[model samples]
Target: VSFGSELSNRAPTFDMDLSDFMDGDKPISYEKAKEYFSQDPSQKWAAYVAGTVLVLMTELGVQFTDSMSILVSSSVPEGKGVSSSASVEVATMSAIAAVYGLNIAPRDLAILCQKVENHIVGAPCGVMDQMTSACGEANKLLAMVCQPAEVKELVSIPTHIRFWGLDSGIRHSVGGTDYGSVRVGTYMGRKLIKCAASDLISQSFPSTPTQSCDASEEYEKYGVDLLKSEASLQYLCNLPPHRSALPY
Candidate 1:
């Protein structure tokens, strides 16, 4: 599959030649592409383009000799908490895969797009945006679990109900926002909680125990392991106000 682009009065200009990007008669390296994209602000989409090429090259174990062109026109507003980047990344990946005759599954393709966004685009993002864009069905909502990265359920929207997006007129970029710091803060919070629970356990259970200690007391005791368990975190998040000890 080959892509060709010609500039006209009514068309957009997009023409990229893979052969022209050779280094000493060999294909340009990913490192060189990364460096070139990193140095230019006008080539913001260069990372995504390089990411698509690199992923396809790695998967196929062959250099792309043909030139490809992409002309994108979208009405969707950029930023504003919307997934403009993910859409672009997914589209780019799909186009490249289709042109290269690579049979990439939707989920796998989404994962690749997420990796490109995170590593190449310098945006710390989860797979939600890419996955949804790739796998979403019409008139349905996708429920997903991020930890293991699986779709739990798909619920159909009621016919009577309509959904529409209203631009808030505020532009926000994930890289420019405090989103990365928020994620770091959450991890740090979990670590602090685990440490505190461990300290509490050490203070409560010493090597020398009282004579009153028995099976019943052991059954009632909650160890640090239990406190640090996954279930414990869920419980803490959902605990009732009266029973909750941790501040929000």
Candidate 2:
């Protein structure tokens, strides 16, 4: 497999031997790719996207029977919170989909590419970058609700405001230990808060007086208020400022 930038005039940046990864029509997998390409970060990413494509094909019940080469190229800088990896995955996914004549919807492609990063790449990242790289129009800023890549619209860049990315010399890798640790910690907090809220909400808010105090215990709920017209504990965004325990 060869990875190159379509925008660049130079040769492909990375050439990898994928014979071992895709041996004779055998389906690729997350574990195989992870262990095989662990030593090379670049190759790892390449393998992940290819593996993801295979996984998707299997899920769709496509009887694919041949090993194929993939090309993923991008000019975006890596490890700086840019969509570098995502751009490559989008390009590769698009190419492979085209080759297979699979008419994958753009939004579905974006979401699946996100899985390539989050699950296959072992990077706990949102799908904003994939959505941007997949759905962005020329000279237009993609506006999306990135819970899992919901594209609302695309807005043109205003002449008055220019988006710039200057190198700070500090590098970032989404799959790195620091990034993973932070994500895990944040999600841990969410879990703790959700558990606490489940106990806080009383489903029987306005119940008739119980015949006995023992029956009152049953009426005094200690869990999610599912009976409410709207549940409020699932998402942090639904919580109001005054009522929320955590600061924004």
Candidate 3:
């Protein structure tokens, strides 16, 4: 979809039914389109991208007139550990941003895409997939810390070794119950560690200790209460410039 970067202003309009949206009306807001497509098992990723584009646009301060439709056809196999979902998301976002004349850097774009999946798509996935998709080069390894997506460097793939994606033969979804359970358990561990660390600090210190952190730092470190609120979650890594209406 290299053509996405060359797309003209405003998404091309298509006549779509109003009942196919969230409010059951003609104006196709991202939320409405997402909810509509989400009702069908076949259109799950469609819903994901639908929600993603609008939120991205909002974050960038683009004036959305609604009435945008996406047509996707992917060759990436589903139910594999492959970045199929991320491919769609990144492509859709890149396309929409291009059409709207939004100049998003690849790294920042990857972060924005992750926000869409975690917040809008309701998937608790890490940033590797989006980061790799957005910033990776051909025949190079993307090295990074998944601590809220810090890119270290891209290592060159050597001629001595070739990477292969072997099928496990068992179909899996990132949104599946097992995956969700693992994520829940990870966060649970983090919470326990936080409690333990807090206790250690209290026991060790003579004075009351308070961690000095801005909202962004706190969010990246823990993904705690600040990230739980919808408003804050939408702008997880990057706090939106306009926060006058934000509760935090």
Candidate 4:
């Protein structure tokens, strides 16, 4: 819930103290944090915080000249496939940004959280969980797209309907589940589409003639065009179940 930083003589260090989970606080040096990430069996979820910090420092060029301490107090159940990890990533980034007096926009913050989950945590997740956690409005359902992540709309919830959540007591981790396989299957399907619809892709993109296009480049260009074209999107969505199953 709290993150504090102070100047340090050695490399930047990080310590996380979980109030109710772990026995007590554990301090991780910068080198140790890096080592933890590289080890065969990575540091598990604990590496997420360190990874986020490293990404902020390396990718966003946030210069932190101090060691930091993170304290988390939470009752949320983990491994429930309910985005507890995404929430933690967002909170950690927000707290770190606050301590450094950095102002991060909500959408951008969500993207950063996704980066932490995807690149740092090896979760291959989209931005929905992070975006919803970061920008959710009371009594509203947020609509967003992952490719070009943006809040499209916030539909007001109907007053007549009540939303309720039930805990099934079954725990799951995205990295440890079929989530990655599904994502891979989706991309594989897209690649198959690119192959089958090569002529269409070429015709749609006249300027970039398919004759001279590398297969990989063609796939990338087709993906970009597919996401940008409403007609193409609709066609894909309206595909017959049989045709749709072909890619998988």
Distance from true position, residue 227, model 3, in Å?
Answer: 24
Worst 10 residues of 3 by lDDT: 1-10
lDDT of 3 by residue, 1-248 (tens): 11222232223322344234323323345444445555655445444566565566446655556566667656777668898778888888888888878899988888888767765565667888999999999999989977767889999988898887888789877766687667666554444444444434434453635333222233345433433332222222221223212222
Question: Per-residue alpha-carbon lDDT of model 1 for 157-207, expressed as tens digits?
Answer: 999999887877776776554766665556546645544554444455765
**What is the per-residue lDDT of model 2 for residues 125-240, given as tens digits with 9 covering 90 to 100?**
66777888888998898888876458898888887887778999888877788976676566546545444343334334434221211122331353334313122335332122
- lDDT (Cα, tens digit) per residue for candidate 4, span 32-110: 4444554644235465665677667645767665667776544555667777788888878889999899899989988
TM-score for candidate 2, residues paired by index: 0.70
Q: What is the lDDT of residue 164 in candidate 4?
A: 78
* Alpha-carbon shift of residue 215 in model 1 (angstroms): 27
Question: Which portions of model 1 show Cα errors greater than 4 Å?
Answer: 1-33, 59-62, 201-226, 230-248
Estimate the TM-score for candidate 4. Answer: 0.66
- Quantify how close model 1 is to the true structure by its C-alpha RMSD in Å: 9.9
TM-score of 1: 0.70
Give the Cα RMSD of candidate 4.
10.9
TM-score of each: 0.70, 0.70, 0.68, 0.66
Off by over 4 Å in 4: 1-35, 38-43, 200-248
- C-alpha RMSD values across all candidates: 9.9, 8.6, 10.3, 10.9
